[model samples]
Every structure is written in C-alpha cells, then in structure tokens.
Target: MEFWTGLYLMSFLNMACCLPKSSYTVYLNKLSFSTAQSHCLPGSFLANIPKEEEMAEILKTIWDKNDKTATSFWIGLQKNKGDCYRKDLPLKGFYWTVDSSTQSDVKLWETEPSNTCLELRCGLLSVKYGETAATCNGFVETTCRQEHPFICKRNATVTCRRPDILGTHDIIDYSNDKDTCYVHCASGANFTLKCSKDLVWTVLGNQNMDTSQLCLECNKGYRRDASGYCVDVNECEESKPCTHRCLNTDGSYKCACSDNDMDDCDGSKPPTTDLTRNDYSNVNRGKSLLTQPTSLPDDVRTNETDVHIEESVGDVSNIIVPVIIALLIFIVLLVIVAAIVKGCIRRRTTKLSRRKAEAVALNGSNSMEKVNEKEET
Candidate 1:
C-alpha cells in the first residue's frame, strides 16, 4: 500500500512538472506549426511541410530533461498516400505537403493508403507501440497522454496600451497556454485580459493591448467564450422571423420564406404549389377583379355604335312593282336613244359620200363629150 501511494504521488508531480505556468507571457509556448504546417521555415514553401529531424530532436531533448527515455512522440510525418508520389525521391520534411522542391520529382503516382492522403499534417507514432514507419499518421489508436517528448517555444509578450471598460464582457484574460485559452473560448467563454505581467485576469481592456482589432465586442447576437471566440446564440426557435426556414449563421439566426405560392396558404405543404388556372400564385397579388373581372371582354366592347337604322328602312321603303317597272322603262329608253344616234350618224355619212361620187362621175362624162366635139370639128 505504501509503495502504491508513493507511485501515485510521483505521477501527480510529473503531471505538473516543467510545464510553463503562462504560455502567453513566455515565448517557448508560441504556436508555429500545428498538426499542419509543421515543417518549412516561417512563411516558406507554404504553411505546410513538417520537419522530421527537428521534431525528433525536440522529443529527444524533452526526454533527456525528464530523465526518462520515451518510445515515441507525435511526429508531423504522415504516410505517402499520394499514389506513385510515394516512390518519389528525397524522403524528408513532410511527405504530405509534397513540398515545392519535391513536387517536380513526382513522376508516377500509386494508390495511397485509404486514409493517408487527406491529412494536412501527419502525426508521429511512438516507436515502442507502433513501428517507426508503418506509415506514421498516429493512426490505429494513440493519444497525447503517452508522455512522449514534445517541443516548446516562447512567444513575444503582448501588452495592451489602451484601457477601456465597456463592460464586464469587454475584458480578455491572459493565460500561460493560449491554446488552452482558445479551447476555453471554443467552449463558449471569452478570456478576460489585463496588462500587467502578474497576469491578474480581472482587469478590463488594459491600456497596453496593442491590437484593437483582436480586442472587440461579441457582436449583437453572439456571446464571448473562454477561448476568445464569439459563439452564436441558439435562436432557432423564436428570434428568427422566417418561420419557413431558420438558418444558423456565425453569431445570429436568419429566417427565409419562399416567395412562390401555389394555392392554399399551408406553410407545411412542400414540393407542391396551390394555384388556380386564372389565379396568380402569390396570395398578396392574385388576379384582381378590377383588372380582370370574371365578365367576358365582349360585354364591355366599344359603346359608340350608332348605325343608321333609318337608311336601311328607307332602302326597303320603295313600292316593289312601281320601282321594277320604272327600271324596265328606263332600260327601254336607253336602247331607243342608242339606236337613233347610230342610224343618224350612218345616214349622214352615206349621203355625203354618195354626193361626192356622183359629182365626180358627172364631171368625167361632160369632159369626155367636150373632147369628142372638138375632135369632130
């Protein structure tokens, strides 16, 4: 029992040992690369590229300081799941990012392990439990509590220069572990910060905070979290006016209603519209009787019709027999006139031609007789 108790105490001590009290105040705990962007220099190649040798060295240093040799630390080298790219040369840095320098070497691609290619960065596996190789993505069941060696870095201290206490919610607290603080923020609580090095969290916006942008209020609909994030207030039920559709946005809610209406005003009906042949779809703007009344267009045709009924009556008023008789008489008179005119013209022209012929014949006979007398004498 005594031996077990001693072991428990030692385990507790180790859990709290050598860990930085405040990461925000120190530089060693600063974040450079995560499961992603583990390799490559600051802003080089890409935010990706995991450095293997350096990561291994960090773990080695950690183990040395702890006076205990660990089997493995989570490394950022994932398997080469990129098909034929796996066979490409110079196996270094992060095999996942395909670092700019190595991309040219990729000639053929082979099918990658089903789960290998998708990760932004690979996890390092412990050499003791899993193989040093075996495609280390920390797959197959490994967690962070394994006491593997880890690397640590300190970040430059941030000081808030301007002090403002808009409210209790305006303050952001500084912590040794910004990652932990961020996690707290993700859980729906914001950090309350202060300016002094002692790191008391009660201070409002400290006069020393340099970045005013990062120091802000949780917008109207959102509330702050311990991690520094503004979480959305769950307003799916009432805050949204769009009863038809409620969409959850970053920090607020939105209501969306469909404009198309088929027939009945049933909100629950879907995939079908309610509309009549002559009725327009929208309930607010259906066919107005004032514009298109149920009456036929002919009922309201032009009302200025003033046809002369008296003229039609007068045209039928003539005595039938007398009118026909008058027409017959007029026709006979026209025939008689035409015949007389023709006869007169013919008689006149005949008389004139006959006289001309007779005169010529008589003159010829007289001249002949005179010629005979003169010859006999």
Candidate 2:
C-alpha cells in the first residue's frame, strides 16, 4: 500500500511540472537588421535561421494572408572571417543567436554569388531566393531588396509571466525558471522574486537581514500603516466592512446585528413618525405596486412608507425617460427609410415611361420610311 501511494504521488507531481506553451509572432515594421534584432528584448532574441525542415516550418507560420508577396527577411546567419570574398574557404564560426551551432548541411542560396559588394556577408531569406548573403547595413525601399520586414523567433524555453501583487501596476518579466519572476516594489526597488518553489507568491526577504544584498522586508497579512510602521490589520475600525456592530480581535473581526438578523444591512430602516400605519399607508400605494414588502417593520413604519414612495418615483422616471428617447429615434429612422423607398419607386416609374415613349417614336419613323419607299417605286 505504501509503495502504490508513493508512485501515485510522484506521477501527480510530474504532471504538475509540464512545460509552458510557446508562441511566435511576426513584426511588419521596417527596421535595420541590427535595430530589428535589438527590439526583441526582455525575453526574445532575433530569429535564427533553422535547419532545412525547420526553416520551411518557420516561414510557413509567418506566411501573411494579407501580403502574399514574399518580402526580404533577416535571419541569424553570419560569418566572422576578416576576409569577405571567401565562399568555399573555412569560416571561423557561423552561429545562430542563442545556440552556437555551425550552419553546414542546410544550403538554400541562389546560383549567383553573394559577394557582389566586398562588404556583403549577412544572410537574407525569401521566396525567390531561398537564402543569400548581403551587406548587413545595406538598405532600399523596394520589395525583395536588402531593406525589408523580418521575422523574430521566440525562445521556446523561456516563459514570461506577470506577478500577482496587490496595488501594483508594474509590469512583471518572466524568465527561464517557472518559480521566479522580476518585479518592481512599491518602494521603487527592483528585485527578483524567488520563493521555496511554491505555487503561491511568497515574499522571500527577511527584515532582520542585512540591506546590502537584496532584502525583502514585508510578510503576508501586514502592511505599512500611515506612520510608516508595519502594523496588524485592525478589524473593529469599521474598515472591517461589517454591516452591523464590528467585534474586533487580534487577527480578524466578526459582525452581528442587535436583532439577531443575518441579512445585510441596506440602511433603509425607517425613521420615527407621528402618523400610524393606517393613516399614512396610502402614500406607499404606488411603491408597493412594484416590490411588495415580505413583512412589517417594528417602530416607524410611516417613515419607511415615504422611503418606498420616493424610490418608486425614481424607478418610474428612469424607465420612462429611456422609452421616450427610444421612441423618438425610431420615428426618425422610419421617416428616413420611407423617404428613400419612395424616391426609388419614383425613379423606376420615370424610367419605364421614357422607354415607352422612345418605342412609340421609333414605330412612327418606320411607317414614314415605308411610305417614302413606295412613292419612289
């Protein structure tokens, strides 16, 4: 039994530690190769030219439906040899952005040699030319030229997640580790948050520790009061937000009503009045028509009656004003639509009448032409 239980627990823990989802997005803004690479900061780097099959997949993902024409794109392929005009010669090192792997078996270049300019050594990929080398700093406005849009590949291993902190609007940055995140605190201090690998966010700093090397002070359930000292939350000060009398304690507070009522206090209790229930009952006639009371109040039922009457008037006004405005708008739309339909009917009738008159005139001219031919014969 103990062996089976331990096995099940290990399986559960393994499932909980699955990898996060990965995503990649294309940017259309035209930028220089170096500048475009720098823009993919925080957690991503410039897209690296992948292996033959992988490059095809990446291009397929970024294939734009709106712009089907293949544009020039920058890839993470470059040679660092001082001599520029060497193609078959051994390169010092050709590497991807993150991984320093050599670009060997994947050959996707045109037949034309790339070193037309002595300074051209950067790699460019597109539909026409599978892969070609060019000057990294060259530029032109035309499509398929050196200056064009590029695709940036996201690092699949790294995932950025926002931290859950109260009263903080600062942006949180994610990293390779799932249990860690970078955030800015209320004191304008920037720090990396790392707890004991727990799911919940726990402040890992100690107050008694030295301040030189990243000290996190506050703990859960305690905050800096107005006097800048950490104090326990007060429950009885009505900030406990209890509806009735607040019972203060060391850690929390409890609420209880004098009449032993559990319902939320809506502050609608009636005030004392001289009139009896029957004398001023007629005043609440319109109000009771909407929401009838379930039971009777104890002391000042007359005051409660007036409160309901005012609420009914307010509700009726809110309903009536919107109905009137909607009716006016509907009438205006109906008039405009009717005018448009009438104009269309009038134009159609005029067109039919003109066609009939033209036909009659043609028949009359044909009869005259036949008479002239008979007279000549």
> Top TM-score: which candidate number?
2
Expressed as tens digits, the lDDT of each residue in 1-377 for candidate 1 is 99999999999899767443322111122232342233222222211123444334444444344332344343333343342324335433234333334422322122232333443433333332222322222222122223233232222233324344333334333455332221122223444444343322332344343323334556777765444445677776545444355556566655444444322222332223223322331322434533554442332211111123433455677667678999999999999999999999999989866765665577786755665565468
TM-score per prediction, in order, is 0.21, 0.36
Give the least accurate 10-residue stretch of model 1, judged by summed lDDT. Answer: 298-307
Model 2 earns a TM-score of 0.36
Deviation from native of the Cα of residue 236 in model 1, angstroms? 2.3
Ten contiguous residues with the weakest lDDT in model 2: 134-143
Candidate 1: which stretches are off by over 4 Å? Answer: 1-166, 169-216, 231-234, 237-241, 250-252, 258-377
- The whole-model C-alpha lDDT of candidate 2 against the native structure comes to 0.52
| Model 2: per-residue Cα lDDT over 114-140, one tens digit each | 443334355555543223321122211
